[model samples]
Target: MSHPRNTLRTSTFSCTWCRVSVPVATADGGQRNHCPACLHSRHVLDQVTGGPSTCLGAMSPIAIAVPRAGDWTVVHRCVRCDELACDAVREDDNQLVVMRMAVRPLAQPPFPLEAFGTL
Candidate 1:
C-alpha cells in the first residue's frame, strides 16, 4: 500500500520573548496569535498587508483594550520596528499578567495625581 503525498502537518511557533512552544490553535479551536503564558508575539505577519512580515521583531504586550463590543484585546508593540498590533485574549491566558497590564495606566498616570486633589 502507498501513502498519500498530500498530508497536513501539525504546526507550532516559539514565543519570541518567553521561548515557549505554542500551538497554532487554542483549546477552544480558536487561532492563537500570542503565547498564553508571557503574552509575547513575533512580528511575523503584516497587519496592513495581511501577509508575512520581514521585521521579525519581538512584540511586547503593552496594554489591554476593551471596546464597546465587550471583547478584550492585548496591544503589543514591536521592539525593533515599533509597530503596534493587537491579539485576542485566550481563556488559558494568565489572568495576573493581564490584570497588571490593564491597571498600568491608573497605576502610573501620565499626569500627576495630586492635580485631582486640588479640586
Candidate 2:
C-alpha cells in the first residue's frame, strides 16, 4: 500500500553517493534534496522544463553560488546527461565541502590572479 504524503515527507532517503540515510526535512522543517555529508544529489528533476527528469544519474556537487540576497546554493551536474541543477544549501550542510567548492575557482584560476592586479 502507498504511504500517506505526510509520512513520506518525514521519511529518509539514502544518499546515492555516500550511502548515508538522510531525512527529507531539515531541522527548520525545510525539504532537502542533497546529502549533507557528500553534498551529492540525484538527477530527478529538469531545471529547464520544470518537470520530472528521466536521466536519473548521479549528480556531483560542482560549485557554490550566492545570489544577491539569499542563501548559498549548491550547483550539481549530472554524470550521465550533463544536466545542471542548483539547490539551496541547508544550514547543517558540511561547511568544509561547501567552502572547498566555493574557493575552487580561486584556488585554481584559469588565468593568473596577478593579472587582475594590473587592471
Candidate 3:
C-alpha cells in the first residue's frame, strides 16, 4: 500500500534551549509551537506572512498574555533576529515555567511599588 503525498506524519521537534523532543501536535488536537518542557520555540514561521521564515533563532519565552477570551498565550522573542511571536499554551505545558514568565515583570518592576500607594 502506498501513502498519499500529503499524508500527515507524526511531527516532532527538539527544544532549542533544553533539547527536549516534543511532538508538534498536542493531545487536544491543537498545533504546538513551543516545547512543553521548557516553553521555548524556534523562529521558524513568519508572523506576518504565515510562511516559513529564514531566521532560525532560539525563541525564549518572554511573557504570558491572557486575552479577553481568557486563553493564555506564550510570547516568545527571538535571540538572534529579535522577532516576536506568540503561541497558544498547551495543557501539558510546564506550569512552573509558565508562571515564572507570567510574573517576571512583576518580580522585577521598573517602577517602585510605593508609587501605587499614592494612587
Candidate 4:
C-alpha cells in the first residue's frame, strides 16, 4: 500500500518495532532515511527523507550505535542509506545496541538534551 501524502513536510514515522524517529540519510545528499550507527530503518524507499515507499521491511541494525542521545533518545547512523536518526532505546530494538546505547551516561551526556528537556 502507498502512504498518504500529507501537506506537512515531516512524515511522522519511526522504527516499527522501536517507535522512534528514524534518522534522515545525509550520506546520499539527504536522499536516504536509514538509521546509521545501528543501520536500521523502516524501509521507506525514497529519493529523499520523510517520504513514502512500497518497501516495508524493517531495516535491521547491522552496526554499532555511537551513543548520541537527545532529551530521552539515542542517535544512530544507518550504514545502508547513511541515515542519521535517534531512538529512545526501546525494548523491541536490537539488544546489543540497546545495551550499548544505555551507556550514554558514560559519554558526554549527548549534546544539549537537558536544554531541550526544559523546552
Candidate 5:
C-alpha cells in the first residue's frame, strides 16, 4: 500500500521590517527563513538548543559573511535579547542590502583609517 501525499498548504510570512509578504521558499525551491527584500528575520529558533525560541525578537541584518567554501551568510542580531544568528543568503535576497553589509566594515573601520598609513 502507498501513503497518500500530504495536502499542499500556503507557506508565506510578512517581513518584520519592510512588511512585505514573503514566501518561505526561494525561487529555486530552497528553504528561506528571512525576507528577501529587507533581509530581516525573526528569532523563532534557538541557536544553542536548536529548538523553538521564546524571544521572538526582530532579527536585524548586520553584516555579511563569505566563507572559504564560497557561500555567503547573513549575520543577524536579536533586537530584544541580543542573540546572534546566521542564515544562508539566497539569490532572491536584495543585492543592495547585501553589498552594504559586506562593505560596512571597510567603510567604517573600528580603528582610525589614518593608522593604516604607517603599515
Candidate 6:
C-alpha cells in the first residue's frame, strides 16, 4: 500500500476536467488514476495545488492518441520527469476544452503564420 514515492504524493487520480480515471500504481496492479479527458491536471503533487511547483510548472498536455477500446488518451509531459504518460480522457470532460486542445495544433502553422506571410 506504500509506494517508494510516498514522499512523492502524486497518487494519480481522476481529472475533474476529464471524467475518466487514470490508473495509479498499486500493489495488485495499476489502477486507472488519471482522468482521460481534458488531461489537465491540478498541481496537487507538490504538496500543494495552485502554488509553486516543486516540480516547476503545471503539467502540460503534450500528445494525444487512440488506445485500445477505441478510446482516446492524452499524454502529459511531467515537468520533473520530462516523462510522457498517456492518460485516458473521460467522457464527461469539458468537450469544448478537449476539442480545442485537440484542434489547437491545426490552427497554428507549424512554421508560424508570420513566416508564411513574408513569402
Q: Which lDDT values do the candidates have, in the order given? A: 0.86, 0.90, 0.86, 0.49, 0.87, 0.58
Q: Clashing residue pairs in candidate 5, if any?
A: none
TM-score of each: 0.81, 0.87, 0.83, 0.30, 0.84, 0.46
Instruction: Provide the RMSD of all predictions against the true structure, rounded to 1 decimal.
Output: 4.5, 2.5, 3.5, 12.7, 4.6, 9.9
Q: Please give me the total number of clashing residue pairs in predicted model 3.
A: 0
Decide which is better by lDDT, 2 or 4: 2
lDDT value for candidate 3?
A: 0.86
Error of 1 at 110 (Å): 3.3
Best by lDDT: 2
Candidate 2: what lDDT? Answer: 0.90
Model 2 lDDT tens row, 1-119: 23447674557889999999998779998888999999999999988999999889999999899999999999999999999998999999999999989998998778888988978
State the local distance difference test value for candidate 4: 0.49
Minimal lDDT window, size 10, model 1: 1-10
Which model is ahead, 4 or 5, in terms of lDDT? 5
The clash count of every prediction, one per candidate, is 0, 0, 0, 8, 0, 13
For model 2, the stretches where C-alpha displacement exceeds 4 angstroms are: 1-9, 115-119
lDDT of 6 at 35: 45
Q: Select the stronger candidate by lDDT from 1 and 6.
A: 1
Q: Specify the poorest-scoring 10-residue window by lDDT in model 2.
A: 1-10
